[model samples]
Target chain A: MIDEIIGLYNYWVVIFLMMTGFYVVIASTNLVKKIIGLNIFQTSVFILYITMGKVADGTAPILEEGITSYSNPLPHVLILTAIVVGVATTAVGLALVVRIKEAYDTIEEDEIHDQDDSL
Target chain B: MDNLAVIQVLLPLLSAPLCLLFNKARLAWMIAVVVSWAALFVSLSLLVMVNDNGPIIYEQGGWPAPIGIVYHVDILTAFVLLIVTSIAAVVMPYAGKSVEKEIPVSKQPAFFSALLLCMAGLLGIVSTGDAFNVFVFLEISSLATYALLSQGKDRRSLTSTFQYLIMGTIGGTFILIGIGLIYMKTGTLNMADLADRLPAVFDSRTVHASFAFLTVGICLKLALFPLHLWLPNAYTYAPSVVTIFVAATSTKVAVYMLLRFSFTVFGVDLVFAKLPLTEVLLPLAIVGILVGSLAAIKQSNIKRMLAYSSVAQIGYMILGISFVSASGLTGGILHLFNHAIIKAALFMALGAVAYQIGSTHIDALKGLAKKMPWTFAGFAIGGLSIIGVPLTAGFVSKWYLVLAAIEKEWWIVVAVLLVGSLLAVIYIWRVVEVAYFQTADDESDIQVKEAPLQLLIPLWILVIANIYFGINTSLTVESASSAATMLLGANS
Candidate 1:
């Protein structure tokens, strides 16, 4: 039951973070804030993948002599790639935000849309 | 021939980095053009090989399926490969002048590099058999796409790129989750293995949730009507070359994935019978068709109008799938090629107009036919294609769809298809009227001239392909029929 609770606990956290990140993205109007929300959303996914890597009473995926068991390594490797993608996306998003600030003088979504409309 | 398969994708993937090493814009462009043409040729050969031999199952690193990575070069993959390579091949020359005019000279290398990367990613997505490989290639293409779109000088492009980034991440995450769920249940990522394993686990709520999540995510990426809010702005604000590339191929690739997941992975019975996806999708596609067309009629910007029309066209593809007939799926699959040519030509013509003229706003196109006859003529042909007029590729797709609908006794859907075509006529006619008939307002002192040979060459290539394929649809129809059969799986 304790182990089951822990397993359930991990899933709950992933779901909570995912929902929170999605909420922030939808509710926030500031483009930068939305990017941050996006980061949180993607980070939650990284956590989910990492959690999947864990095996009960198992060591790291790298095999060593005398090791009876090891956790699944595929999710860990996939998450590493996902993290790289996340960082690249964030960097690109931030660069676009900087450009948006320079061009429109505002990074807020509503203001930019209003400005675009006026144009 | 099979060895050529892996190298086809790798050639452009390698060229992207090589192009980045170049400082000269012209040299970089020349390299991109050569690489893309080579990629197109390889893709064509693969299509022909697949046509003759059915599906070519290439085990990457010489490892068989249910164990090692695989690249399944079936009829459907070959068909999509052709669409993607064809677009890349045509878009390169147009990219040279379009990029020069819209983007600064210093940024051209990065722009072309991102373009090549996007192409490689799309090819990778289509060719790979590993489910996780799909996600990896998706990121490669999507990351490049964000950078490409942000190159647009318009301020809203930044915001549009940001919006797409957020949504794209969400979609990608959901797909990853779906893949993870399947992996947890089945312990394999190979598609054929998953297909076998999935049916046993189909009754499980976790697997069902994964299927739902994956479909929603891919459809969102495909810009399925209601989830398509990120599209119009992204298309309208993206640099002309980027717009052409994305409008032509991106969503179609996503649609490909959707069909892949639904038919190949999940199985049609599970997806359509158990989940009622067709019931849900059929109505939604109808809604999207009406909504997208109506919205397009209202847009003043030519690019935005085309973008919305794209949303409607996607609905038609989905609508075709909803019928569950071989002909229906063939219509959808064939439209995947036909619409790519139509939209690419349409956008290339628009890019040509935007190149010589300042803007793409419909009102600004006064007497453009008198000024740039070839460009307008191309636009007019593309317009007819979009409206499903006879002797254009679009007519063949709608004809197949209507035949399927009539066979299925879906009279209403057949009527809606016609209505959608009429709406396309309305929007296309609006632009034609402005371009041909409207007298110039005084501020239009810009010297109107036909687009340069470089731009005209690529633009007309697609325009001619649109009509040529309409007449000689043997290759398209045969490939599409085989693809539809494959999409429905071995037993439909």
Candidate 2:
């Protein structure tokens, strides 16, 4: 039981972060906070990918004469692409929030809807 | 040696940045029109090539498969390519007039650029054979979509766009996580390789979880019933031309993803025999059909009403998929193509109305048939197609769907199919009733003219194609059935 606990530590952290991010995304009323929550959620997935790439006592993937062990680099490279996508999403999300603030005069979801309802 | 498949994706992608280079909307729109037509030519050639040759696998940058990204253009890919490129070709020309009226001169170029980017992203998704690459292209298209949808003159567009962004990003991330889990097990991101390796680990918990993630995520993207909350508002609030382009293509691409992952990558046995897909998936589809049509009937806004109908149309495709038979799958894919044509034309007509009358509320459309005869005629014909009237494109799809259900002796599904068509008739009739039967308030003096010829030409083009394809079933039926046969191959 103890071995299992230690062996799957990365997964436990992923689940925790993922749930926290999702909760904030669902629970938050502020649009900016929601985008932040999305960032956190995406970050958890990045960690999950990096976790999959890890190997015990493995060095960074590089060609060398003496190094016999290295972490799998594919997942890390894939995560790099994902990181770019996540960044683009956040940029767009924040830009929209900025416009929402300009147009609605509030970043709160309830306020935005209330204003719209009045219209 | 052939570069047709890559060029099919690259034209819009390369031209997107070029669109940004121009400060003038006319220049950007011109570039878009040229590139979109070139894309259509490229895709038409691809369909022709795929028909003659079985499948063309184009390795990216001359790198071999399972190592580098390759585009696997089979009959299915060609069919989707045809749907997407043809829609863009028509919509891009229509945009010249619509964009000028709706958008300010300064922002118009950005709108055109974003539309091209969105098109390229969708084409990229359809062309790539790598699992991870799908997520990248999905985000590219989605980001561009939020930007496009938020361009509505109404402030509510911003809020709807925010809602869509939140939902779409979550969906894309779920797909990412699913792909990650599958990669953890198989150590490959190439779809063809994943399919080959998946059967060995069919019972693994990770595989099951991955499948679940992918399905829920795609359902959100495809707006499948309960997951469809984001769609109607997004479609309703987007600018007219944006609505026409997105309403026609985005969900169709998402459906393509569902088909690709479930059949091509996961295989039918894994989706049907191994997993409890039929029970859960089938009910959502049937409910989507009935509820979508019913909800469409309740809507007062024409755009929102059609948006709900799109939800139901998506259901028909999913319902066909749930059958897990060749005819069933054929019906599903055929509906995918036919719906793109039918819905594009329908949305295009609404776009023309929006262009003239400035809104699409049922009350606003009172006697609009008299003022805008040609445009309303287009909507009326497209409406008939949506209702599955004989000699329209919709009938061919519904015919196949009902036949497939009957072949399974799934009498309940067949009944639902007929009931769904009847419901469509009620909602479509509501629009025709308001447009043709009712008159505007006596003092209001409805002064709206027919939409500009720019809009009518493309609208009529799609409307004519709808009736033509309905009559000439050889092209769509042959390709769709062949594609279905390929997806269901060796499953027995």
Segments of candidate 2 deviating more than 4 angstroms? B443-446, B490-492
Clashing pairs in 2: none
Q: Compared with the true structure, what per-residue lDDT tens digits does model 1 show for residues B348-465?
A: 9999988888699988888788888999899999999989999999999999999999999989999999999999999999999998888888745877788899999899999999
Point to the candidate with the largest DockQ.
2
- Which 10 consecutive residues of model 2 chain A have the lowest summed lDDT? A110-119
* Candidate 2, B-chain TM: 0.99
TM-scores, one per candidate? 0.97, 0.98
Model 2 agreement with the true structure over A16-118: per-residue lDDT tens digits:
8999999999999999899999999999999999999998899999989899999999999999999999999999989999999999899998888788861
Please state every model's RMSD to the true fold in angstroms: 1.7, 1.3
Clashes of each: 0, 0
Mark the 10 consecutive residues where model 2 chain B has the least summed lDDT. B439-448
lDDT of 2 by residue, B126-241 (tens): 98899999999999899999999999988888888989999999999999999999999999999999999999987999999999999999999999989998999999988988
Clashing pairs in model 1, backbone N/Cα/C closer than 3 A: none
* DockQ of every candidate structure: 0.65, 0.72
